[model samples]
Target chain A: MAIPAGITGAAWLLRTVIDARDLTTEVAMVYLAGVLLVASRRSWGPAVAAVLASVATYNFFFVPPFYTFHVADPKFLITFGVMLAVGLTVSTLAVRLQRQADSARERERRTAALFAMTREFAVETSADEVARTLAAHARTLLDCEAQVLMQGPNGDLHPCPSGAPAVDDNELPAAQWAFHYHKPAGHGTPTLPGSSHLWLPLLGARGPLGVLGVQLSARGASLAPSQRELLETYVAQAGLALERVVLAEESARATVAAETERTRSALLSAISHDVRTPLASISGAAATLLEDRASVDESTRRELLQTIWDESESLARLVADLLDLTRLETGTLVARKEPCPMEEIIASAMERMERRLAGRQVRTDLPDEVVVAPVDPVLMEQVLGELLENAVRYSPDTSPIDVVLRREGDLVALQVEDRGPGIAPGEEEAIFDRFYRGAGSAGARGTGLGLTVCRAIVHAHAGRISASNRAAGGAVFRVEIPADAGPGTDRLSPAGAAL
Target chain B: MSPHRPASEHPPGVLVVEDDRRLRATLKAALAAHGFAVTDAASGEEALALAKERAHDVVVLDLALPGIDGIEVARRLRAWSTVPILVLSARGQEQSKVQLLDAGADDYLTKPFGTNELVARLRALLRRAGRGDADPTAAMLIIGPLHIDRAERRVHLDGEEVRLTPTEYDLLAALAKNAGRTVTHRRLLAEVWKDRSEEHAGRLRVYMTYLRRKLERAGRPRLLTTQAGVGYRLNAE
Candidate 1:
């Protein structure tokens, strides 16, 4: 109201200046200019009011008996009629142009929002994450509660957990209807218009993937037509994101399945070959002794019995390796750690491997000071046992095998060095793979799982194990376990009479 | 190995509790061949019943029995009798094996063991039980070349006196009491520290290392041996 009145007062002042020359037509043009200015700058209501005010002021001040509501001549009334016509036309056109600009700005905003949502969805690896992003945007943009109900594996709609607010049980039917028919339903929609929320299907290229429900009525406000279009675009983008996530997940599962199939076949063949060889020897020896005890000579019978014992021992070791590998692969073997003296663990492993290490020059270099480390003693012993077994199996009996233990800063280092051919270059890491037998170790009586089990056990201790060529001409397997100071770790001086 | 019987009119009685039929028969036959009058039971319940019916010199129990588990059986047996229990445990059952030994079991032999090892462990348990009592007040204890004069609290390795700290002496004495047998960590901790908490294990290990260093002699074999996950053992070579 103030803007129209201000424009009318300015037009009156302009008419006062032009009335000296009696340019009545020019005076009317001044009032027309003020009305046009008001129409172009303000809304239609104010602009129309400005037109009526301009005409009244023109008649009372410029057209006749000056300052009265009377016109001197009837021709000036035509001027008033043309002025009103032009003012109304410009006001209508200006309002249409303003509406067009406002809608354009709204469209740009929604487009940017869609771009941001798409970028967010690109990083989302799962359908649940995409739903969460969508719902969060809806809560801020639409100013209402939102939920994205996705179809589960069994084709039933379920809201993504932790992504949206709790959905009303009564509204599920409307949501389901939208999902099935790929149309809008509930309060602001034609179908199920009695429900409190607006449900629209998230359509994909294939079909409706899910339903997006927005509680506009619960917030006591309905979305404008443009806002509704924005919501539909959001739903479409989310649908594509969900489809991408599902496809990626399916492909990943296929890759794992294929890999598992390959491993299964490899394991089966390795087990059959390794297990049958020992079984053959044991059964063959036993059957011979049982069938011909009297015919067999004393020494020959002893030899057969010894073969049975040795082969069964190897068989037992094979079974143990298999069990350990299975436990490690299945993530069932948790390292039960405690502070243990490294020397004690080494001694125990050596004692366990005494028979195999008999007459072999086994040299050990241990620190004078007691080095304590947090480790599962039993598992550590197994790791050392495997390393030692590998050394003795590969190295010559005359060559010395060195076992060195050191405390390097915060880590406990144990290296088993053997005077044998070092690990074949380029196979350092491959040697730790399951069923990986070295080229030189083909006929060696081992299940090929020893190093794999060793790696797994060391990993459980949060330690690392590696094999490399020793500078002095052999292979050295090094294991380093973190020796964080824990309970009962009292640093004492080296014993005076330490060996 | 042959059936070398002890110098007695009656052979030592043995109760073998194992669930697998084949393994039970193998154990029965093997123990019988080693001059043990074997009494076999297929489950822990039958083993308990058999124990009540007769006085077995030693009980050989399988850890994974079907009815009553080995630890429970050992606990129930210790509630009444003093029969030595030798548990036959699998490889990866170290924690349960420790629990079994703590529950009144004397020794354990891991599965896939040689018959000679089984006989040796059984013999050790039988000999320890036959000592009549722990005799904590005994004046002297001798194991191999090492001797402990309990009255004087002095230790000698190879006939030469070796100096030891008080805690070291206690740790050795605890292992010496059950020399040639595997003692669980809990038992040793309770005996030496008088507190069986696990935190004391590190201290026990450190002291054992010190004792080993002190007991080392030129041209002499290793005597104080670590039993891996178990506690120390004084080898009676």
Candidate 2:
């Protein structure tokens, strides 16, 4: 490499002084070159050294009429003073510019790291997920093996295991101390300076989220001042992300708990009202009959007994449905799968509901071929009974109720159709909701849980149930259950299917 | 309606604690017809007062009283009297029923119970009170041709032992205890399904049918006669 312009000028001045030619010009030129070198180097100490070297060389080689260490003229002393001042001033300006450049680069790197970490945190849906992502990002940014130790229930440290090496007791203590104090500890820190890990606490808005332990590689002598600041920013962001996930989980749990409580309370009130009315009537009727056994005729006694029996039957159904609903909501309803003949279920439901549907005409269209499906007999009967009851209540007495059972593919479908006022538009879905009766369908004696229970039972059996207005008028409810003849069919007992 | 029929001549003095005015009146009238000296109370406080004023043989206490809950009323009544208390609760909460029974009620009857069952429960309670600590096994009850050995848990008709399901046996036993009186649907449900609420009348009916088939003779169901709107009556006479 060719000598720099400033160094070459210094050499030229030295030769001129050795020749004892133009001493004053030589000293001045050498001083200017020394100042230029100091400006380029941009250090105070180097600039001072250059000034002293130029003066010593000038005094020894060019200050005098011959090569000597003495200055002969006082005017040359003024030149030395000016050289020192100029070198110091230029070095100061250069050093300030270098410091500013370093600061800008540090800020840019920190900003970029923060943006990247925040984006990753934002996409994370769970606290453990965020912890893993934060630990990974921190490890890359800090250039160390980062481990996040969270505070467990009993004041113990729980380190997230996401490909991070285990931290020893001593190193963990340092991390725990930082977490407790919400500050940094160990190596390069005043607290436990000999510790190998740089422990930083993740301070959140509420409090400390956890401790972040970073074990540096041999290459990392000490974290730069700027790097320490960046580490703090990273911990803060990770803490915030963890806090958000914790809040989201807690809110979701609370919402579910509140919903369950509401359902329980409403069920209690409805059950109370329904149960009490029937009991009162039955009790009153029995007491009257007992007191007037002699005065009352046989016919009157029979009528009262019939009312009690019927009312009691209704009350029993309400209770069963309530229990079924509770089981459904709790996700505890177990379907007892058996190869039950559709005919038997239909016959039983019809026989049970014969008294209720006394005035209504019922039409049946069962194929000669026996259709079988894997279902709970009791539940299926309940589902069919509800459908039949709905038909009896909604359909006019003159119109006949149609129950059609057919097989399609590996599934069996049962559709109950009635000819009355068809379900209105937009009400098809609403009718299936618990406690929802269609508009203009007043005086319908129902607990409103019949369809809901039916749907829950159908769904539990892995079947699909839906309602739609029939083309011939009135409403049609269709239920399709998978056939049981296929492989992997497991038959469950009735006791196991109580729910 | 007949004042000449002395209160002491009645079967028993019953205190009916119900909040609904119409329901209370109907209960009082119905219970009166059964030859019970029925006293009506609208609130828990009134029930307590009425219970205290007289030596009631039986108390029909509603759980949903105005002043205090039926369970609380039962608890308070049990503190002083050994009267057979039948709790009437609208809520079919199993825990509440257990609590009430634990609080010293002899039996718990949910609301919407038929009069026959109510009377049957009352009769059972009265019969039980008359025989304190008596051996249930020693007493053999006969309903028409069907004979029940309470101690052995055996049933026989015309000297032939009959097999019955556990549920059927329980139903028959309940009916036999209240023989000659009506057993309402609600009481049957509560007795049969201890944890179940009054809404399980269908289950009770199914069991009743089973018991009738096993106990009743062919062509005649004289012992287990359906009281229609009331309840089943096990006629001893």
Candidate 3:
């Protein structure tokens, strides 16, 4: 203010020291310089004030009237007009140059902020971390509170596992709608314009990954188009970063799955050698005693005979199960179809385990009319044998075990019921998994392959099998096979099908 | 007990090829005590060399060998002689049984067999071979109008020739051999498709239905009878 005032006053004082006619143009040039200086340094208001003041000074001190309001020479009015025009033009040009410089500086600042945000997002490891970075950067860059949200498996948006500048519960619906529609919602947008925060969807190549919510105040309302563009760029970068984190986690999980498969195969081969060799020795030693009984005493001979018979029975079961399990793991086990009656195979299975069942009550509930089923007799027998063995081992000696056979519309179901403590809740399906032993049978000796092998055998036959607690005490193991038997995939019961 | 009864010998010679050391010794001792002479070999190569040197009435070979598997040994043996090769394999390996049989093995017995089972299978082999002497597949198996000639590997229904798949033929042949008796479902599948998985039984049922449809003559098909809820039998009309 002082510089423009002092320059205009000195230019007027110069008129008294020189010939007014010869100094008029020089005085006019001085007033123009003062206006230009004020305009470059200050904003348009102060610069415009300097322009009007310079024109008034020229009319009063340099016009023909000199120090008076009236002008005698009419041509002096032209001089006055020329001086006013130059002062306004010079100030206007200076103000425009100042605006261009300020805009250039703003561009550099925005670029630096974006570069920093990119570096921050690149180092994030998980989706939560990515969201935190996005929210923090958004709050700083957009001058508002920001929140990030991710979608759950059921298609509902969840606030980032954890982050700050968080979206409140009330804002969740707006964010969700934005995510579902893959567009911006809430304040300023056509959708939900009354919302306090604007929600922008973070869309990736596949689909919308999440949403970003931001709240602005009065200062934010006047943002220029360029400032809004900078905010949009930040949001776009945030979307890409969020996807990068999610994809990385998914790939890591896949890699772990593949590693687990490799480990499982290696363990199976190891089990093959460990199981068969020991079984060979135990059964072989027992066989030697049976074959050479003539050299031994009567008491010793009887024991040897029992030993051979029992060991061979167990050994046969173990060897067969081990081979079958190994083949199943490799996807090499295939079902061979044939016609057979269900009654005889189940009876034979019971007969093999008769000694153990001698003390227990046994009953057979079979149809009066013979039911013929097309099945692999060997495989079905094995499945029934495993189930019966399990019943004998788990049930009390006084409890009765019933073998029930029934026919459904397009399938036949065979069930073995034992009057023992029923299957544990929630563990009914897990018992069929390889190497799973029931909690109640901890002390009972087994390789944990019996029930697992049964399931594989049943599945190969295009049938279904399950274990459940019977309505009247104990557990029931059921198997359902198709009547026509052409690769049928019917379930044994509706309950098993739901599972 | 007589020395000069004109019998071949009091003890039969058996070649036992096994990989496990303890099992091989036990098998040899048990077979020897059962009035049979047994030779032990630890590997397929050793067994091959022993077979080339001396003749044995029967050979028991294990499937899991270090260098050459039992199937290769069976194949190599077929190039020279027809000594009944009895395979020793783990249970539920019916595919291996099929491969061995296709490679010229005569029969198979899963591991952990008692002395009685071993002796029974050997005696069955010897008895069947002695009955024919030169031809094992001699008498034709007849069931109703279906004539199964084992020697020619041909089947005829109602006196008209019938073209059958390998599995179908095997199923019919097994049923015809046990014409008056029931053949267990497991045994039939093991003999025909040589599959031991459970699904094979379901498939077996489908094939049984197919067999009945194919055998229908003038819309009157002879039923393949079943009994005891576990086996199949053919009723000749």
The estimated TM-scores of all candidates read 0.79, 0.47, 0.46
Sort the candidates on TM-score, descending order.
1, 2, 3
**Order by lDDT, highest first:** 1, 2, 3
Please identify which of the two predictions, 2 or 3, would achieve the higher TM-score against the true structure. 2
Query: Please, what are the lDDT tens digits per residue for candidate 2 over residues A282-346?
Result: 99889989886898798989999887887787777787678788887677767655555576567
List the candidate 3 regions with Cα displacement exceeding 4 Å: A1-381, A392-412, A418-445, A456-464, A469-474, A480-499, B1-9, B133-237
Q: Give per-residue CA lDDT, model 3, range A1-499, as digits (tens).
A: 5765687678867866664667867876787677667666777777777767766666776766677758787776776676556656666787787888888888888898888988998998888887778788777877777878888878788877444544667777778789888888877888887778888898778888888888854234644677678878887888898888878989999998998798688657755754665467566757767677678788876776675565556556665677788786567876665556576566556655656676777677977644556677667887888888889888887888899999888888999999888788998998987667788887775557788889888888789999899898899999998877433423222221232
Query: Local distance difference test, per candidate?
Result: 0.84, 0.74, 0.73
TM-score of chain A of 3: 0.56
Per-residue CA lDDT of model 1 for A349-464, tens digit only, reads 98889888988878889999888888888999999999999999998887889999999998999999999888888999999988888876867777788999999999988899
- lDDT string for model 1 (B19-125, tens) is 99999999999989989999999988999999999989999999998978999999999999998889999998988887887787878888899999999888877
True-vs-predicted CA distance for residue A11, candidate 2, Å: 8.2
Task: Return whichever of 1 and 2 wins on TM-score.
Answer: 1
CAPRI category for model 3: incorrect
Name the candidate, 1 or 3, with the larger lDDT value: 1
What is the lDDT for B106 in model 1?
A: 78
Model 3 whole-model lDDT (C-alpha atoms):
0.73
